[model samples]
Target: MAILSDITLYPIKSCAGIALREATLTRAGLMTEGIYDREWMVVDADGNYLTQREHPKLALVTPRIKANTLELRAPGMLRLEIPLGLPDPESAPARTVLLWDLSLKAYDCDDLTAAWFTSFLGLPCRLVRFHPEAQNLANMKWTGGVEAPTLFSDGYPVLVIGAESLRDLNERLHKAGRAPLPMNRFRPNLVVDGLGAYEEDYIDTFDFDGAVLKPVKPCPRCPMPSVDQATGTFGPDPLEILQSYRAKPEVDGGICFGMNNILLEGEGQRVHVGQQVGAELAF
Candidate 1:
């Protein structure tokens, strides 16, 4: 039987993720300690989103949930903590930011946090949290007309990948005399074991623990995967290897890896690690 092997939530996009033994499966993605996935983001002075594609070192900024705060730690950097409680939207400094095709409102964090990120990244940057009033929806074209909401994710609410898929890629890398990559390189929200290689690409629905997650879109590959999450450094790129076989004509011949998903039911349900998953294939 297929079961969830790991669940990770990225409080800040392109930075680091928190592994949870159990978390709430919400329409906007995984939620733990009242914080939603990609709930916080680091942006430039122009309010443009920043990611590992441009600043690979962002991967080293690890976050931990402390009592009443979200503590951020990085190599040779001082620890920074932000309050977990939501600030009043009416009083907080609001700014307009752009994430791909969507332009949304967010709360600009304080100068101290901005300076902290700037110091670590060697450039000017500011930290921002999703405004309580912002409403950003995923493209319905891929969701079969279902308007799924997401919080600062590149496109969808969830990204699911099968364990065997990574094993398959690792085997190929090994055959090519390259080192195997870890699951963090893929940055999937859900990792399931006991499925055939690349089977998640055809997943119709994942029914587990009264929750229904529909695989809606194929996740295109990017250079961010080449950036090692632990060292925050770029190394041997795997996209070239993937180009040989993983290219999807449906996505304009882009090399793909995981499946972007949308929540269909059980908005407030808790999903635990090691729980059995009922995977329905498309055909």
Candidate 2:
């Protein structure tokens, strides 16, 4: 049986993810301690998003949620805590942050938080939370006009990949004399085991109990995967190897890995690791 082997929550976009045994399945994505996946983002002075693609050290910024705060930790930095309370929209400071083509309103965090990020990153940067009222939906072109909601995620609400798929890639890497890669390199929210290699690419929906997630778009890989999650540095790149066989014609020949998913049902359901997931294939 195909089972949910792991569930990861990325409290901040493009940063380290928190592995959870159980989490709430919301329409926007995974939720833990009232924190939604990709709820916070790191941005430059102009409000443009900063990701591991540009700042690989972001991979070392680990986040953990407490009773009423989000605590962040880095290699050489003291832990920083930010309150989890959502500010009143009318009174809180707001900024028009540029996330792809969408310029949505996001609340600017305090100067201390900004200083912490800037000091650690060695660049002027700030942390911003997604506005409570902003409708930051994924591109409808990929969702078939479903208007799936997301926060600071690159595109979709959730990303799913099969564990065997990674094993297959590792096998290839072993044959090529290159070191194997971990799942963190891909940063998927859900990792299912017991499926054939790349079988998630053909699935219609992943059903766990009553929760449903539809795989809508093929996830195109970028150079960010080359950044080692543990070391926060670029190592032997894997895109060169994927380019030989993982290109998807539907995405303009972009080398693809996981499947971009959208929540279709059970918005308030709880999803757990080790739960059996029924895969309804599109075929």
Candidate 3:
């Protein structure tokens, strides 16, 4: 009896995630209060995406959903509030931002908001929102021809990790005289319990009551995991330890952790923590 142990929604790419008791599952990822996962992102002066991989302090930028605004707070920085309403597409300021190989048109945030991020990160950057008309699709090569849409995720709509997987890694860390890391270190969108260690790697689909999530690709590990979510600083990286056993030949020998997923059914369905999950193993 596998249970959905946790649900995390990351409104911004590579920033802190919000733990939710329930969230609406969408093709683009989890959504709550009309805000989709990775709906907003920070970009450099050249419009390239920025992340905790470069600035670990991004983990310290916390967001809270207010009545009509997305309130953001950071260490030693004043609270910044962004309107929840979508701006008019016809006249809203837009910019061409580069996210990996995809070039996307996004709504450029206000100058004040840009200044806030710039001052906090100590870099000239601006925050951008996913444009309503932008079409960001996952690679069909990995999706088996299923057209999976995403916002600013690396390559998938959702990431699912098994709880026992972390426990297994923690046990190894203990043996190596290293500190155990939290689930947030991996930043998975869905965490399932009651599965064997690394069981998610063999799962093909996670069937909830009205939704079906298909595991499409293996999520590769990055140095960003070394960033402590609490301190927003780099610590001893776990990649070396993971490389010893978690490297996958399918992903060209990239060290992997979670499974990148796509919505197979019930796009608008709501999923909650503690709900029973039926995992179908891959043949």
Q: Higher-TM-score candidate among 2 and 3?
A: 3
TM-scores of all models? 0.99, 0.98, 0.99
lDDT of 2 by residue, 128-229 (tens): 999977788877998888979999998899999999999999999999999999999999999999999999999989998989999999999999999999
Off by over 4 Å in 2: none
Which stretches of candidate 3 lie above 4 Å from their native place? none
| Residue 24 Cα positional deviation in candidate 2, in Å, after optimal superposition | 1.0
In model 2, residue pairs whose N, Cα or C atoms come closer than 3 Å (at least 3 residues apart or on different chains), thus clashing, are none
Poorest stretch of ten by lDDT in candidate 2: 132-141
By TM-score, rank the candidates, best first: 3, 1, 2
The list of candidate 1 runs beyond 4 A from truth reads none
Give the per-residue lDDT digits (tens) of candidate 1, residues 1-283. Answer: 9999999999999999999999999999999879999999999999999999999999999999988999999999999999998988879898999898678899999999999999999989999999868888888999899889998999899999999999999999999999999999999999999999999998899997779999988899999999999999999998978999999988999999999999999998999999999999999
